[model samples]
Target: MKKTIITISREFGSGGREIGKKLAEQLNVPFYDKELIEIAAKESGLDKELFEEEDSRTSKGFRLLGALGYSLGGPLSTITELSLNDRLFLVQSQVIEQVAKEGACVIVGRCADYVLKDYDTVLNVFIHGNMKEKKERAIHSYEVDERDIENSIHKIDKRRANYYEYYTDRKWGRAENYDISLNSSTFGIDGCVEIIKEVAVNKSL
Candidate 1:
């Protein structure tokens, strides 16, 4: 198969991560969700907890040029020099670029669409579901408290939106920014995966 990169942005309870994993398996490529954190940690020599803490959170400091550069591998790369948020962002951005450069892979979240914006074979996707369905999915799949599910969903999605916009200068969940925006509510997770697979394959060919 032709090399292609798929990036999935999702609402907290949307099951978009599952679709990305299945799509990657169908396409015979590595899937990067949690694995991305490991890669960044290994390459950057940062604590894994740093990645989890800054996961999808906006950078606390402004250094657009620094974030764009990836060759910060030396003694100066210490956490004391760079903010943890900026360091993780740069390292993960580098890791994302490295993976896409290698070949086809499905990356879920982490502003991946914006990270690979210049790549020719990348397919950017956004997945979402209605509040009612998402809340139910959280309750059934994640066993989130029924009483707290709605607030939890809103809080998570707001963070995602803020992170995306802060880094990419693009609105989260906006259809125009992505190659395709899918509603898991309209099409089930399997259905969404099939459609994404079809689109990714066709584009690769």
Candidate 2:
């Protein structure tokens, strides 16, 4: 049997991870999320904490700094110094490619779509939810306080966007960048998983 690889890119509180896990279960395939980080860390000989920090925040810091000291000038050259974060990203990118080549799996975030964009069998998906729905989900699922949910959402999404844009030539969450874009808020997590499964099975056939 031919294997199918699904890559899901999602908004911070959209339950995209849950959907990916469910899809993997339904498809009887391996599911990858933070497991990617762990694998990357082991392969790259980098600390897991560094990978977590650099996962999606690289571009934001540089953008905020502007083309000033570290942005475009001498400090920028210094910034070129590959921090542990850069090394981790490079290692993780390789690991992601290796995993995709091994078999069918559902990979969530960390620019897996871009990493495997050249693969003919990969199906890339972008999952997002409306602000209200996302916030509610974050609060309930993550146990984030209502007061902190909005800020957490913003920070995480921004970091994800920054990381994606920095690494991939494509824009994050843009419909054009993905083979399919689904709103988890519209169908809920399980429904979205079902949709993904149907889509994957149909595509394989």
Candidate 3:
């Protein structure tokens, strides 16, 4: 039987992780978030701490510039010259592909949607919330000061966007990049999970 794999990409402070977790529970499937990096580290023989350090973070401009220049040389040169972050991305991408091939799973972030884009049974989702709601959620969930939340939100989202764009050649958070784009603030967390579950069931049928 075919399996359904849902890939969720979200903005910072949007509660996408919670929604993905809940959706996985409702569907009785495994959920992957940062754990993907761990698996990738183990599978690829890369250091786990280095994987965590580079995951979902922006690439350095100098390194990207160097990579661009190096790409003009030859395929072998380009591959050999990849920055540490880019190498980690490649490793994690392989791990993601392996996991998807294994069975059904709900994968959150790390460009999993793009990694699994060619799979017929995969559903890609983007979750986002208004700035106000996101800030409130960040403050409550992370126990951070209100003043710091805005900057934290922007910083993290920018990093995610950069990381995703760097790897996928796609605009992050754009509706065209996903099968469904949800505003989690509109219906709240549980409601959003229910809606996703309903959609998953319908899609499976």
Candidate 4:
């Protein structure tokens, strides 16, 4: 059987991360969330904080090479030419591809969906929820400060959208970009996981 990779793009406070972890446990595969940042930092010898900062904010310039998964392919002296955000993105994307190549796994965020776009055995999923449901999850589950919680959610989602669009040239959360889009509000976290789990398992057949 061939290995399968699952990449999840989620709205903030939608419990999408939790669903991804649960699905990985059910399938007995590796799960990557913020772990990707740590791995990239360690592998690239860059500070972990750099990856954290670049993970959300949109890049200002120096996009083309990184978006295309270019690695400079030249002397180490060439690395200095790229912007900080572009450098970090290229490193993190390399980490994403390496892990996917290792085996079946679930990777959350950091544009793993776009980075692994060419993989034949990959399943891309986007998870979203209504404002009411997402707000509740944000406050109660994620503990996103109750004060101005709605604004906080909006900011996070927008950052993710901008970052994704800037690199992928595709609209984030659009149905056409993913193999499956799930409404966590309607199906609930476990339900969504079960749905993805079934599809992933079937793909390995």
Best by lDDT: 4
lDDT of each: 0.77, 0.75, 0.75, 0.79
**What tens digits encode model 1's per-residue C-alpha lDDT throughout 1-205?**
4337899999988999989989988888989985765566586554453444442333332233245633333432343445565555766776787888888899998888888888878988899999988998899888888887799899989998987776666789889999888999999999999888888777554
lDDT of 1: 0.77
lDDT of 2 by residue, 146-197 (tens): 9878889999899999888766666787999887899998999998988878
Off by over 4 Å in 4: 1-3, 44-80, 203-205
In model 1, residue pairs whose N, Cα or C atoms come closer than 3 Å (at least 3 residues apart or on different chains), thus clashing, are none
Regions of candidate 2 where Cα sits further than 4 Å from its true position:
1-3, 43-80
The top-ranked prediction according to TM-score is 4
What does candidate 3's lDDT look like per residue over 111-169, in tens digits? 88877778888888889999998998888987768877788899989999988876666
How many residue-pair clashes does candidate 3 contain?
0
- Which of candidates 3 and 4 is the stronger one according to lDDT? 4
Q: On residues 93-177, what C-alpha lDDT tens digit does candidate 4 reach at each position?
A: 7678788888899999988888898998899999999999999989888788989989999999999998887666678989999
How many Å off is the CA of 120 in candidate 4?
0.6
* Candidate 1 TM-score, true structure as reference: 0.79
1 against 4, candidate with superior lDDT: 4
Stretches of candidate 1 exceeding 4 Å from the true structure: 1-3, 43-82, 203-205
| lDDT, residue 76, candidate 2 | 44
Report the poorest 10 consecutive residues by lDDT, candidate 1.
Answer: 55-64
Which stretch of 10 consecutive residues in model 2 shows the poorest summed lDDT?
A: 64-73
RMSD of 4: 6.4
